[model samples]
Target: MAVARRRHREPHFVDVALRHRFLRHAHRDVQRRRIPLPIRHPGGPQVKLLYDWLTKEQGKDVVVTREPGGAPIAERIRHILLDPQNKGMDPKTEALLYAAGRAQHVSDTVRPALERDAVVICDRYIDSSLAYQGLARGLGEDDVLHLNEWATDELLPDLVILLHLEAERGLERLEGDPDRMESEDVSFHRKVGEAYVHLAREYPSRFAVVDASGTKEQVHTQVRAAVLPFLAPDRVET
Candidate 1:
């Protein structure tokens, strides 16, 4: 498994490319298995990358945009979460927003992609909520899990790639400007990292941790190595 660390300040284009490669490969592998290819939602620090990649690399035709007041329900929830007024919202309400967004994302974006045989590489998924809201927001695991179940009807990813990075290194990679959650203190980021580690340990079969301390290419190499197995029948040669 690959584990890469990341900070809110770093540019996300590299990470976006890595995620796209991983999803494209995984989609092909699943097709080989004669099963429906699963979609990927790049969550956490790489969310914005989803928009850029879809528009530039994947083409607007293949990607459905989720703008505010757009057809996608997830976009609305995203708007709510990113709003500064959300800071004082209760944990349950926050969890509900995430769930609402996930539901819309899956039904609107993911389901259509599956129908068209297109690989859906999402910017973020339910895991972000589990980590940010469930763990960081101090909601108990049970509550978080329950909300997740309610939101996605218990649908989980076939594979979850957790980019593992040291808090200090991740922060350093950040370009100084951070979003609401990204701007959180180092201590909170540490907790988020710890939560991801715990998840990897808890679900080894589904989780892959990629080391993210190296240069972008180096980290991409590690990520590609981790994803190679899911890409083909033979284990990744690397």
Candidate 2:
């Protein structure tokens, strides 16, 4: 019988939890889905509260960090890469810069945490590159992927929750002027969307796509559902 099914991936600067936070109540585990809007919307306070509640319920089992900015050196690099004034930056140069920042971040932050057996969850990771530079910039997914592999010693995410949103809709959710990537042409954004969709299918094992258009609670419900099973905590009732 024929049926329907779906999947997903990530974007943005990297920031996850400690590597062992989920089971040991200390570390991080990456989530596939993201709902930034709910965290900013007028009613988004509920989502933030839910997150605080859940994290508290889980105890001090996670460490939230972002790459390219988590470490001081890398943060400087992040500024250079994302500054709208740097739009003239070559695509390959941009990709390489991200990888460089990641390399420093991993060497200084990620690897050390994992060595301590901590679950490290990062906000954006390799998948972001595959979507932005790989697909959107026409830089070949395999190429961007290979670049990151070297950057992180092939450290793959345990999970990648994609907050699936159309480019236009995603843009509308923003309050400030668009950043370098966000400021790209509509067609460019459309390509980014396509790239994400493609990535979901290409990497289903760790990727789970969730709708970003739902209400804060609705969206949080899905993200919580996806992450709870992994944490196997005394599940927060909310």
Candidate 1 deviant stretches above 4 angstroms: 1-71, 233-238
lDDT of 2 by residue, 164-235 (tens): 777788778876877787778889988988887898787665566778788777877776666555443344
Error of 2 at 49 (Å): 6.2
TM-score versus the correct structure, for each prediction: 0.67, 0.76
Q: Pick the candidate with the highest TM-score.
A: 2
> Which candidate achieves the best lDDT against the true structure?
2
lDDT, model 1: 0.51
Q: Please give the CA lDDT of all the candidate structures.
A: 0.51, 0.62
Tens-digit lDDT track for model 1 on 1-238? 1112111213211121122212222221221111111112222333234334434543422343331212356666677776765567777787777777776766666556545544344444556676777887788666887776665545444455576778778777766456556667889988888877876686575566777665556655554555444432332234
